[model samples]
Each structure stands twice: as C-alpha cells, then as structure tokens.
Target: MTVLVVTNDFPPRQGGIENFVRSLCDELPEVVVYTSREPRDAAYDATLPFPVVRDRTSMLLPTARITKRAVQLLQEHGADRVLFGAAAPLGLMGPALRRAGARRIVGLTHGHETWWAGVPGTRQALRKIAEAADTLTTVSSWCEDQIRPALSPAAAQRVRRLTPGVNTRRFAPNCGGEQVRKGLGLEGVPVVACVSRLIRRKGQDTLIKAWPLVQESVPDAKLLLVGGGPDRQYLEELAVRTGVSQDVVFTGPVPWAEIPPYVDAAEVFAVPCRTRRFGLEPEALGIATLEASAAGKPVVVGDSGGAPDTVRHGETGYLVDPYNPVAVGVRIADLLSNPQHCKELGAAGRQWVTEEWSWTRSGAVLRELLDV
Candidate 1:
C-alpha cells in the first residue's frame, strides 16, 4: 500500500501536531510526506526515511494550489491513498482531493478542532471535510467526541480513534538522569517539573499560586519550569510576587533529545492544562505526561479534555482541577512525601505505557482502519 501524507506541520515546526505527523510517518509503510517549502527544512528533510515532496507555496497550508500538485504526486507515486495531518489543510481542499480519484481520503483531528467547531461557521466547514473523508482519525477519544457529532450518522462512523503515543526507546526509565540534578544545583531534595510551552492555558500561574503551600510541607523542594514561551516574564514576576521566586527555576526550552533527563530529574511531573482557567482549549492529550510515565515518574494533570487520559488518576498520577492550585500542591506534596508510593505509581505508569501505547501499535491500528 502506498500512502501520501500532506501537512504544513513537520519536524522543523514544533507542536503536538508536528510531532504526531513525524511519529506516524516513521511507523507507516510505503509513505511519502509532503510539506510546505521552508528554507530551514531543507537540511531536516534529508534525515527523514521517506521521500519528501516540498511544495513551493508561501502560506503555511497550500490550500489554493494543493489540488493540482496532490493529483500529480498521486499519479507519479502510484499511491491510492492520502492522509491529511490536520483539519485545516484537509478542509481547504478536501472536496477537490475527494474528486481526484484516490481510493481513500483520511482526515486526522486533534483537540483544537473542538475549539474551532465552537466558532460560528467552522462547524459546517468541519462537517464538509469529514463527510468527504473516507475515514477520520482522532488523537484521543475526547477529540473523537468533538468531531463525531458534526457529521451525519453515516459520516460519523468514519471517525476512528488513533490515540497519541510516546517513544519508549527515547523516553524510557533509567537512562542516566544524574546530569539534570547536577545542572540545577539541586542535591537530593524533592523536585516537581512542568515541561511545556509556558502558555496561560498550561496553568503555570496556578502552580505558582500553590507553591507557598507546597513549601510549607517540603521547604527544601524545587519547582522546575521547562520550555519557553511568551508568558515567561509574567510567570517569573508572578513567582516573585508570590514569594516563591527562589524556589522556582525556569529553564528556557531545552534540546529535544535532552528532555528525558528533565523528566527523570523530578519525582513528580506536572502539567496543569485546563479549559476555563485561561479560556482556551484544554490540552488534547498530554504527550509529556505519557513521556513522564515512560520515564517512571508519576504525573499530575488537570481535570480537563484529554489531560485525564494521560494520568489514570490514583493509579499513574492524580487529576486535579487546574483552577485549584491547592489540589495541585497537595498532590505534589503527597507524591514527594512518600517515596515508596511515588515509586510504585511511577512503576505502574511505566508498565501501562509499554503495554498499551506504542507508535508501532498505533500505526498498525491506523493502517487497519484505513485498510492500507
């Protein structure tokens, strides 16, 4: 089976969707990738195993010109299937791609589609593309719920679950994590690390608010904030204002390969992503949460969207309300205070991820659903 993946999001770009596309392409067979022309991607493209087609389009999504080029690539490569990375690129030319005579036209939806579906006219746009698609895949059951209702009963049947997974090979437990602790100048005190884009929706502010209470329990503890974004200055100031500035450490965007150690550095990993705290879409799925699970670290996620999916609540980790910092603080303290319980939860999580969510398993599921 020959499969062609078309998307604006790829390796050089950073996001959940970009990472998803890269992971899927790595597992799927006889796949050719199509991405927008970015000068930086020129070097990155060479590292990929599949043949990549770079379209010379100025915009991120080649909506206006994708039709002609897609048909041409389909014929040249003898491919009978096309997979769109996300809904926007698929919506732009979905109808045209449908009439182009491909055996299957698949649309993949992430959590953001729910936010877009809530907008005035986007529901109909999503309905159109999904109806035209032969099969539609969602990153999580939460996202599947978002897109399924928009289409007709028959069209909705096309919606299938192809959940996100972690690369256990790169993010497994026991890969030498001593480097992370030494770099932070921390010696054997409990640490809670949150790794993500420092956006309001991620609930960094809420964590900051709860730090004082956390300190009251474990005064020697440290909170490490990894990854950089626009909210850094505000969060830094808020940390100072909250009187926990000295206890908090913000390491601006660490290298991708170096992330596992950061996960290993802490006993508990927190990502309090929410729906209403910052009035944004809740996290679709916490890939970092899964990464933490792989690294044998218990996670703390918000009770919103797919955040709960990552942590099994009382098993792998705790699911606290992102708006309630007290809950977050308490969970962090519980994990840190009892080292044996923390280790048990982390071990259970590591075993769960290894057995259930792997790229090879998810790819095979997608392959079967698409009949490719």
Candidate 2:
C-alpha cells in the first residue's frame, strides 16, 4: 500500500518539522506527498523521486475543502495508508480519508501537540485526532508523556514513539567546515554555533544574553547564528544591545543541504530553548543539536521539554536551564576553554549517535507502525 504523506511543514520552506517529514518520506516504500504550497516548490518537487501534490493554500486547515482534497489524493494514488506529518489539525482529516478507503492512518506529533493536550478546547481536538489515527507517534518520551494522558485510554494505548533520525555520514567531523570558515573569514576563531529559527522559544536571545560571559572567558570566540525567522530583527538588535554584534555572524536562511558545513564550522553548538505559553510551547527534540553531535561537536542544549532527552549531560554535552543565561554561558565557555574535554565529549556523542540514531533504525520503526 502506498503511503500518502500530508503536512503543512515541507520543503522548500525550511524548519525542523519540514526536514523531519521530508527525511521520513525517503524511508517509505512507495509514497505520494500532499503538502501546502511553497515558493520554489516546483523546482524542489521536480528533484524528488515521488509525486508531490501542492495545495493552492500555503497552509492547510482541516476544513471541508481540505478534507475533500486529501480524500481525492488517497483515491487517486490508491494509498491505503495516510501519514499526517505534524498531526493535530491535519490528523483530523483521518476519519474523512478512512471513509474514502484509507486502511491505516498515522499522525506524527512534535512538541506542539503536547500543548494541545493541555488546553481544554484544543485538548478535545487532539483527543479526536488521536482516536481517528490508527497510531499516534511522539518524537520524544517526554512528548509522549504530555500527549498520551490527554487521550482516551484506548487511544492512549495506540500512542508510540518515533523520533527523527540523523544522517551520520552527511553531518560528520571536517565535513566542509574549513571552507565555510574561510568564506566567513572566521578561520581559526573559536565559534559557538546555534542552528535553528531565530525564535524566542529556541532562545537565540538567551544565547546573546550569555555572550558577554562567553567572551570574557574566550575573548576571540565568535557566535554563529544560522537560519532566518521573524525574530531576526529582534535578535540582531539584542546582539547589538549586548555588545556582541561584531562577534555575531547571522547566516540568514542557509539551504538544507548546506547545513552540515555550517554545523561543522563551530567549536561548540548550543540552543538554549525554553518552555513558553505557561509551559505550552517547548522544544520537542532538537534535531539541530543531534546533527551537531553527529558532526562531532559537543552541544549545550536547553533544559526545556524534550530537549534534555537529546543530550547525555557531561558525557555527550551539557544541559542548562534555558532561562539562566549565566548557566548557558558557563557551559559554552567550559567547552571552549577545554579543548581536550570538548573533543572527548564530541567523540562520545559521535559514537553514541552512530550506534543509536540512524535513518535505517527510524525508518524500520516507522515501517512497522505504518505496517505498509
């Protein structure tokens, strides 16, 4: 049975969820993708192996029209199995698709559904989606804990864990970092890199706030802020305000394929993510941090939600209180100051990731869940 992948989060729009969904697609036996429109999507889709159906709308809501389109795709592709990339609202269309002859429906939840599990109205909506889907996949155990309780006992039992995988070969040590450093004129500088959307919850501001302390310990250290988001202006202004503007390099919106070189360009990687919205929005599982670890760089991740699940503190990396800039700075500085310690931690991370977190392992679990 061909799997029909449905989601709003897909390339050529760049983000964690987009990359997660796209990577999972390669694992499926036969698949057809139905996602919202993106600029340069035609060029992107043309490069893909399977068919990609773009919606007129840029974002899809589970309205009657959206449901109709999804059902039509299922029938056209003869896809008995349907996979909703980020679950929640998209998974709401499962019932409609089932009525149209879909056998199995899997809804993958990142961190957002954990929040959906809390609020009253959205919690009901989440439960409904959970009931509709044959299996609900959570990216982390913490995420599974947050979302499962909100479902009915039967639906809760169907919840499973299927985290994203890292391509170890693609993100390895010396994978074009020297060239990236040369291009940026950052050759031989001790760099702390954060690769994610420059959003408040992802904590670029906290990284900036912590920069002065990092600089005190390693005065020649530079901050490499990658990816673009709404918070770009705010983060830039905050960097200037913190007096780390000259040392901070913003590589706005790097291509997905080019991310590895940038990841390799850092001495240490950090993302001080925090829970916001009264503990609603949290970092689900930081793919970037895992990528950095895969690149043989020690990571400093935030102690937010599922983020801590990504790092083995002091062994692979350090987990700091996201709200505490001093704590974040200290960890980054410690790694920067001690080259041997950093190398040891990074080597441990690389070994751990190679043994555990590979696309083959993730794909096998997903295949079992989909049973396709």
Candidate 3:
C-alpha cells in the first residue's frame, strides 16, 4: 500500500499545486516522496513524517536517466502505487515505473496540462501519458474538458475529478488577524487582498487598474498584494503609474504558514486571474480563492478557466471579467461598502467550504482511486 510521489512541484517550491500534492500525501498511510532538489528543501524534508528523496536536478524532465532513477526508487521503497504531482511530462515515466514494480499509477493535472491539451505538439505527449496512467486526476471540470479531448477515448474515460481541499481550521474566520492588521497599519482600513504570485495572468495589473475605482468608493481602502514572482517589479511600477502606489501594500513574499492571518485580515479577497497566451494559460482551479472562502472572506474572483468553480457567484462571492477593471472594482467596492452583506457572504462561504471542501473528503477520493 506504500505510495511513491514523483513530482517537481513539491515544497520548498511554493505553489498551489505543491500544496495540493503535499496535502493529499498527508492523507496516505505510507508514502515516499521523490522530487527535485530545491533550496532549503533539506530542512523542509526533515520536518516531514515520510522519507523524501531528492533528485540532483532542480527541474525533472522525462529523460532516460530520470526514469531509471524513478524505477529504482519504486523498487527500493516497495511502493506499489505512484502519484505524479503534475501529470504532464513526469507522468510520461508511468509506463516505465509500472514495468519496474508500480501496480497503480495516478497523475494529477493542474493548469498547464489544460493548455497542453490544445497545442498540437504537446497534445500527443499528453495523450500518451494519459493512456499510460491508471487514472489522471483533474482539479476542476473545465480542466477535465480541456484535457479529455487530447486523450484517447479509453484514457478520457479514466479521467477523475480530485479537486484541492482546504484546511478549514487553518483558514477560518477570526484566526488572529489583529496583529497582522496592526503590523501593516491596516487597522480599521477596508482592505482587498489578493494572495497569489505576481504574474500577468494573475491580473495584479488589472487589480491596479481597478484600484482607482475601488478607492473612489472606499477612500481609505487598501489593496494588499501578497506573494512574489517575476511580475513584482512590473506590478509595483504599474501601481505607481496608476497613482495608487500609496494605497497599495506589497508584502513581497509571505511564507505559507503565515498566509492565514493575512487572508483573515482582508475584508474582501480577490485574484482577478485571467486566461492568457491566447487561451493557452488559465487559472485552473484557484486554490487561493477557496482558501479565502474557507477563511470567511467573500471573494471577487476573475471569470477565467476553472476559477469560476471556486465561487458560488451571488452566494459566496461575485465573478467579474478579469479584463474589465470597472467590473472588478465595482464588485470589490460593493463588498467593502456593505459590511452586513459582506459578513453574510463570508459566513455562507465558510460554511460551504467546510462542508464540501475538507481535506478528509479529498483524501477519501484519493484513497479510492489508489484502491488502498
């Protein structure tokens, strides 16, 4: 029943997919992780309950050497099942691992694979991986639709939904946000927080564009941009150019452990994520939005890809056009302006997430797929 997790997306490489894989692994009985080498990974691995074997390379491709090593690990760990954190290129090794010893193989798909399905070159490779694995799990229905077309008829039939689950206790209302609010000098200020990496597709620029309108409604409102990426400098410059630099607070990058407080401190959580690269890039499932909903914050999500699946529209939050700053701004302003409505939406969001998106439920689905 021991499972071997093969992925390049594990922590100390912080991302939505990394956390999703780690959380699912926590639900397994016995496991061993085989992932790429990352800075500070040794310390992170030491804290984990399972054994984590690191590949010398930082990024793992489906090469002969890597596949050979993966097979060795499969045999050494006596792992009967294999889970690829990201199915795409890594899942290409599934046939090899199965020949080596793995009885069951599961490959999880995130955003990129959805795009891979549409491209002619990558679509063939994606189809091969899909056919080889016992199951290919998708984070949302939109993703399943996008990927299934690239898969063979039989492989498409094996596709299953295994969405990421939120740790409700960790991301609940009143999770001690007072310190964060005081530290950020945001005490009593209406704050709209976007907890995600700075990137074009993530729509931080759109948020900056929308900020002026938000400020018009709630004069003292602040825009909190959390996490860092290549787009930080561009977003900061854009914020300045848009004349809202004074009102926007960029925390650069915050550790995952400290994200709950930042999320709790916000009056409204938003990530105006959009599809990019002419529909090749999408928001996948938007785990941050789910986490915000879990924290009892009404989210203003961008209507892109599977991100819409995270919100219940009028009930939990509002979905806006990611490209339309006016739409995004108006929804955010309305939420901040009406505290009672905000509270109601937040409470309902929290209740819905607690009941439907628990990690225990996600784990049970994984266990069933693994047949363990």
Candidate 4:
C-alpha cells in the first residue's frame, strides 16, 4: 500500500503534531511525505528512512495554487491513499483529490483546528473535507466531539479517535538527578519544569502566578519554562510582577531532540492549559505530559480539555482548575513536601505510559485504520 501524507508541519519544525506524523512515517511501509518545507541539506534526505517530496511553493499563495501542486504530486507518486495531517492543506486538497482518480482519502484533526464555533466559512470548509474523505481520524475524543457536529450522518460515522504516542525508550528515567541538577545550577533546589510553547492558551501566565506561592513553602524550588512563542515578553513581565522572576529560567525553544534530557532533569512537570479566544483549551492530548510521565516524573495538568484523561488525579498526577493559580500552587507544594507520595505517583505514571502510550502500539492502531 502506497500512502502519501500531506502536512505543513514536519521535523526541524517541532510540535506534537509534527512528532506524531514523523513517528508514523518511521513505522509504516511505502510511505512518502509531501511537505511545504524545502530540505535544508542533503542530510534531510539521507536521514529519512523513506522518500520525502518537497513542494517548493510559498505558503502565502492562493488556495488554488496549493491545490494544483498537491494534485500534481498525487499523480506523480501514483499514491494509493492520501492522508492529511492538518485541516488547511486537507481542505485545500479535498476538492482536487475528488477531481483526480484517487478513491481513498483520510483526514486528521487536532485541537483548535476543529473547534470552529463562530468562524465564517471555516465550519463549512471543514464539513466539506469531512464529507469528501473516506475516513477521519483525530488525536483525542475532545477533538472528535468538536468536529462531530460539523459532519454529515455518514461523515460522522467515519470518524475515529486515535491518541498520539510517545517514544518511551528515549524519554525513560535514566539520567542521574544529581548530575542534571548540578548542570542546570539546581543542585539543592526542587525543579518544577514546564515543556511547552510560552503562549496564553498554554497557561504559562497561570504557572508564573502560582510560582511565588510554591516558593513560600519550598523556598529552594525552581521553575524552568521550556519552548518559546509570541507571548514570551508578556510572561516574563508576569513573572517579574509576581515576584518570582529570580527563580524562573526561560530556555527559549530548545530543539526537539534536546527536550527529553530536560524532562529527565526535573522533579515535577506542570501544564496549566486554559481556553482562549479561538476556543476551549485547544489541547487534544497532552503528549508532553506522557513524555514527562515516561521519565518517571509526576505531572500537574489543568482540568480542561484532554489533560484530565492523560493525568489520573492522585494516581499519576494532580488535575487542578486552570483558572485557579492558588489550587495549582498548592498541588505543586503538596507533591514536593511528600516525597514518598511523589515517588509512588511517578512510578505509577511511568508504568501507565509504557503499557498504554508507546509508538509501537500507536502505529498498530494507525495501520489498522489505514488497513495496510
């Protein structure tokens, strides 16, 4: 079975969706990626186990131009099935694929892309793509629910929920705590790490607001903010105003391969995601939480979206209200004070991820849907 995966997001441009798509390509057979990014070097082609075709068109081009290039690729590759990794490219390519001789088309949804409540023409375009596709797959049940209302009865029946997977082997708890702590200048401090883009919806502001309260109890506690985005300056100001700027360290946009080491260096991980103007907390599945859990680190995630599904409250981690910074602070302090409980939670989390969220298991589920 020859499959052609279309996506704007790909490796070297790091994010959950990009990682998920790359991992799927690694496991699947006779796969070719049609991406917007041009290869930077010969290593880009040599690194990939499978063939990758780059469409060297400016992203600012009109929809018709994008559609023409995608259809041209489908014909050139003689692709049996067309799998879309995002809505924009998929919506643009849907009509073109119908015009072509392609019989099977699959569309994938993740978070905010499907949460079109009041947008003009966005819902209609999404519905059209859903109706045109033979199957629709989403990363979480939350996303599936968001898109279901936009689909026809037959289109709705084709929707399937397939959660993203983590590479457990790479993210395991192998790094020595003392060595990592010393290297980060956190030798005597309890580390509270957050690995995500510093955006409003990610709730970095909430986490910064909660840090002072956490510091009052565990005075030696340090907060590490990983990843970067447009909200960096605003979040930095929030940390200063909240009187916790000295203890906070902002490692702006670390490479994807380097993130696992940072995850292993921390004592606790927090993701206080909240709803934004776009929609209700656009998190389909918390892949970072799973990676942290696999490293045997206890997590504290927001109650909104798919976070509650990833975190098991007292068992794996704590689930607090995203709106309440005090509640989030209290949970972090409680876990730090009770080392025995923290260890137990971490152990349970690691076991849960290994059993449920590995890439091998996820690939099997995805392949079954592709029926390859």
Q: Whole-model Cα lDDT per candidate? A: 0.81, 0.93, 0.93, 0.79
Count: clashes, candidate 4: 0
Error of 3 at 80 (Å): 1.0
lDDT of 4 by residue, 236-331 (tens): 898899888898888899888878878887889999887666464566778999899989999999876666778888899988888899999999
lDDT of model number 1: 0.81
Relative to the true structure, candidate 4 has a C-alpha RMSD (angstroms) of 2.1
Q: Between 3 and 4, whose lDDT is larger?
A: 3
TM-score per candidate, in order?
A: 0.94, 0.98, 0.99, 0.93
- When sorted by lDDT, best at the front, the candidate numbers are 3, 2, 1, 4
* Least accurate 10 contiguous residues by lDDT in model 4: 53-62
Error of 2 at 276 (Å): 1.2
Candidate number of the best TM-score:
3
lDDT per residue for candidate 2 within 11-36, as digits (tens), equals 99998899999999999999999999
* Model 3 residue 323 lDDT score: 92
How far in Å is the alpha carbon of 186 misplaced in model 2?
A: 0.9
Error of 2 at 57 (Å): 0.7
| lDDT at 214, model 2 | 92
